[model samples]
Target: MTCKSSTTPVMGIHLHDIHSMASKLETLTKNQQLDQNDIKSILIVIDLNPEPMSIDDELESSKLTRKEFAKSIKKLAELKLIDWDFNW
Candidate 1:
């Protein structure tokens, strides 16, 4: 159950170099160019996906509280980074 990477799991696939991904995400946020809704939605996908992350795990890896993480996911979903249906 160890992903050994930082990118959130998707469809049981663990993206490599999670740290870099996170950095890019941070940059996106800093630029204020990313859609807030999209951020929330992406967080939602990460939260609801079948990955084995606990709230504590998320805190440890993503430095976000459970509530904050949930909120962020909602934003991502709105942006369409993640779909509600399991199509992709």
Candidate 2:
């Protein structure tokens, strides 16, 4: 699916993006000794949105419970993988 933008044609996250992110995460997981839950959480966030999502928005979009979402967000933050913008 393509994103609807007036001037420029923006491409939404695709299968390739997901695969690439997963592969990278897999390597990170092995190196960091991340648990399955952590990996799944990261994958969920990546699959849902490419840009930085508000905590509420991400929780709404993902299948994770509130606690799980919070935990995942904390993990992502700790890894410096996400750029948090409260203003967004």
Score each candidate by Cα lDDT: 0.42, 0.45
Q: Residue 14 lDDT in model 1? A: 24
Best by lDDT: 2
* Clash counts for the predictions, in order: 21, 0
Candidate 1: tens digits of C-alpha lDDT, residues 1-88: 1221123533332222233344456577678866755344334223234448643654666555555544443444443454433222
Error of 2 at 79 (Å): 0.8
Candidate 2 lands at a TM-score of 0.32
